[model samples]
Each structure stands twice: as C-alpha cells, then as structure tokens.
Target: METVRIRNPGMYWDIAANLHFPPNFDASKHYPAVVSNHPISSCKEQTSGNIYGAALAKAGFVVIVPDASFQGGSGGEPRWIEDPEQRVKDYRDVIDYLQSLPYVDADRIGILGICGGGGYSIKTAIIDKRIKALVSITGVNFGRLMREGFSNFDPVGALEAMAVQRSAENAGASQRIDIFLPASVEQGKAAGITDIDVLEATDYYRNRCPAEGSGTRMLFSHAAPAMAWDAFAFAETLLTQPMMVVVGDKPGGFGAYRDGMEIYGRAASKNKQMVVVEGWSHYDLYDHPVPTGVALERVVPFLVQHLGEAAVSRVTKPAA
Candidate 1:
C-alpha cells in the first residue's frame, strides 16, 4: 500500500488516501477497483485502510481508502466538519482520481463504505451513475440517526442550538466541537448509555483501534447539513446499481440495521443482497476478525460478480 493525495475538483482540497494494490499487481493490465470510505471522525489508517483496504487488495482488487475531506490528513478549513453533501461529492472526486490511473478499469469501479461513510456511499451512488456497484457495511443514515436515534436531545431543539452556534462562530466566537464518542466505557456507563453500539464505539475509538488524525470529535456546526441530509433519499429509483448491504444483528441507536434493511427492500436493483451477521454487534464488523471476515467473504464475491474480477482474483459468485 502507498499513500497518495487526490485533488478534490469540487472543493479544491487534497484528499489523503492509502492506495492498496493486489499482490504482484501488474501495471500493464487494467484491474477492477474499489473505493473504501472510512467512518466519520475516523481516518484511513483505522479499519477502512489498515483492515478492509488491505484485505480487498489481497483478494485481488485495487482498493483506495481515503480520509474524508476536513478530517485526518485531508485538506479543508474549520476541520472535522461532517458535511454530508461534501462527503457525497468526495466519493466522486475519488472516482475521478481512480479513473486517471491507467491500470484502473473505470467502468468496473465499486464503492464500499462503513458506518457514517456507508450512508454517504448510498447518497453518492444515487446520483453518480459512474459507480457500478455499492456496498454498505453497518451503515448509518445520519439524518435519521440524528433525528430519531438519540434518547435525550430533541432533534429540532438540537438543530436550533446548532444554528445559534453557527451564528456565534460567524460573530468571532471559537468553533464549538462535539464529542463523537464517550471518552471511556466508564464515562458512558455513568451517562446511562446502555446501547451496545455506543459502548462498543467508546471501546473501539478509544482502545481497540486508534489512529493519528482520527478524532473523537466533530465540528458542532456540522449538524446543520447532516440533520437535513438523507443518505437513502431517492434510492428506490436512482440507486439501480448492483448493491449489497451488510450489518450485524445487534441493533443500536445509530439505526444501521434498520437502514440496511430499508435499503435492501427499497433498492431498484434487480441484483442486490443483504447479509446479517448473527452474533456480532455493529462495531464488531469494524475490525473483529470473525465479523469482518464474514462481511468480506460475502462482499468480495458480490463485487466480483458485478465489477469483473481482476486477473488474480479467484473469488467465486455467491450461490443462487
């Protein structure tokens, strides 16, 4: 794997990405490629690049795991803002970069997104016909999650608070940031957080996996765009590409399980599948060997079926 910087044409920022090539990759031959989007507030070096990207490369696909703009090593102002629109646009920018390489087969490109990245991937596929296949692993629909998932905060009230914060920032106030996950499992327990996903998130972000430039916070003002955006908006008609949605059995406040089921039912694609890993929770799919392995086992074949496999790929089609 090699680190590369891709220029985002729409936003004029450099997206830092880790490009993974299949073993004994041949530049003389074109190969199928996959763009893997890391979870929000996280960087490529975490589960997306270090795990999924590397695994997909080993399975014979060129994989690029990119840190979303405004976070990690990517360039953007007022860093760590989770703008859903910009996130969707960044996928296209990554695809543009992939198309520029001679060894990449532009027509066979696929997208894999996890957590918040999964939601953005759905949104990106709706409008970008260039994306031939879509994979969402434990994906959350951020807008819905913000609106209905939280137990304490009123969604409208939260939006109103965000509006005020944005105004304050415009009037020379310091940028207000919001914590993405609890600092520790103990803190989460004290806060009455009983959701398995939240507890696992704290452990995952704080202990199990941590990477430089990956933070536990995001710009509080990011709520404005994120609250209004629907990752599955118009997916029934626009998302016709061959798709696959994977999620764990444990349902949590984030709504990834619900979102995955909804997308699978609503997608227009005649060729689509959904997989539920029985014993795992949402975070378990991130890096845990068993759940992650199950996901890759299913996803790699689906991708191979849609986007023609590389010369080195030995993955077979799923049983009908």
Candidate 2:
C-alpha cells in the first residue's frame, strides 16, 4: 500500500489515504475497486489498511483506505471532530477519487467499512448509487448507540449542553475533547466498568494494537450532530446495492450484532447476506487473526461475485 491524498471538494481539506494495489497490477487494465473505511478515531494504518486493504488487494481489487476528515493524517481543523455528515461525504469524495483513476472500473466499485465506519458506509450508500456493493464488519449505528446507551437518556439535554459549548468555543473558550476509550483494562475494571465491549475496546485500541495518529478521542462539540444522525435511516427503501453484513455473535459492545441484523433485515437489496462469527466479539473481528480470517473468507468472495466475473478470475490465492 502507498500513500496518496484526495482533494475533498466543498470540504476544503485533502483526505489522506493508503492505496493498495493488487499483485501483478497492470496500470493499463481497469480493475474493480473497494473503499475500505476505518473505525472512529482510527487511522488508515489500522484495520482498514493493514488488514482489509491488504487482503482485498490480494484478492485482485484496488483498495483505498482513507483517514476520515479531522483525524489521522487527514487535514482538518479543530481535530478529532466526528461529524457524521462529513464522514458520509468523505466516502463520496473517496468514490470520486477512485473513479478518476484509469485503472479503476467506476461501475464496479464497492465499500467495506468497519466499526463506526460501517454505519457511515450505510448512510453513504443510501444516497450514493455508485457504490455497487457493501461489506459492513462489526457495524455500529452511532446514533442508536448513543440514544440507548446513556442512562436517563436525554438527547435534547445533550444537545443543549453542546449548544452552550459551541457558543463558548466561538468566544475563545478552549475546545473540549473526550477520550473514547480507557487507558487499560485494569483502569476500567477499577472504574467498575464491566461491559466486555468497553474493556475489549480499551485493550485492543489502547494496548494490544495501538497505532500512530489514532488517538481515540473526539471533540465534544461533535456530540450534537452525531446524536442527531442515524446510519440506517431510509435504508429499507433506498439501500438497494448488494451487501454483506458481517458481525460477531457476541451480544454487546457498540451494538454491532444488533445493527448488523437490523441492516440485513432492512436493506432493500435482495442479494444481501449476513454472517455472525460464532464466539467472536466486536473488537475481535477488528484484528483477531482467526476472526478476521473468518470474515475475509466470506467477504472476498462476496466482492468478487458482485464486482464481476473478471474479478473472480483475478482473485489471488493466499500464499502457503
């Protein structure tokens, strides 16, 4: 994979991306492509690039893993802002970049999104028809997660607080940022946080597989926009692209299992399929060798089958 920058029109920032080329790549020949999106607070070097991008490239597809605006190597101000609208638009910009490449087949493009990105991909495909297929791994619908996860939940109250913060920041108050995960499992345990998803997320992101530029924090002002967003809104009627929803069978942790099933049941695509990896949790599917292997085992064929027969024949066999 090599680094490239894509100009995000109307957004005024260039998106930093890692572009993965297939083995024996022929620049003169057009190839099916996949846009792999990383999770919230993750950089291209995380699962999206190192795992999925590499694997998909090996399977004969040109894959681009981009750092979302305001995070990673991407250019944006008031960094770590997790605005859902911009996130969805970033994918469209990625598609524009992919379509501009001579080696990429514009009509045969697909998207693969992990964690928070899974939700953004769904929202993007709902309105953008260029995405021919979608593969959502451990999908988390952020709006729903926030709505139900909070105790004494009150979106209005949260928004009200955000409004005040925004006003303060506009008048020179310091920007507030919130850490998305704990520093370690021991700290979480001591804090009396028993949720397996939270603990595992801390372990994986904070300790197990930490990466540069993936500081796992977001601007607090982003809450209002994210709280109002819904990744699956109008999906049942508008999401017509071929899709595969992959999630672990485990119960909790950002609601991937529930959201994946919701996506499967709601997507208008007649060719959609869902895979629940037994015994794997949400974070496990992020980089666990066994779980990621299980996911790609199905994901590669799905993309190949949907992208084209030519892609099927070009699929590279895994090395022994």
- lDDT by candidate, in order shown: 0.87, 0.88
| Model 1: per-residue Cα lDDT over 157-250, one tens digit each | 8888888989999999999988868889999999998988889999998999978889767788756777777888888898999999999998
Name the lDDT of candidate 2: 0.88
Q: Which portions of model 2 miss their true places by more than 4 Å?
A: 150-152, 309-320
**CA-RMSD of model 2:** 5.1
- Provide TM-scores for the models: 0.94, 0.94
Give each prediction's root-mean-square deviation over alpha carbons: 5.1, 5.1
- Model 1 — which ten-residue stretch has the worst lDDT? 308-317
List of clashing residue pairs for candidate 2: none
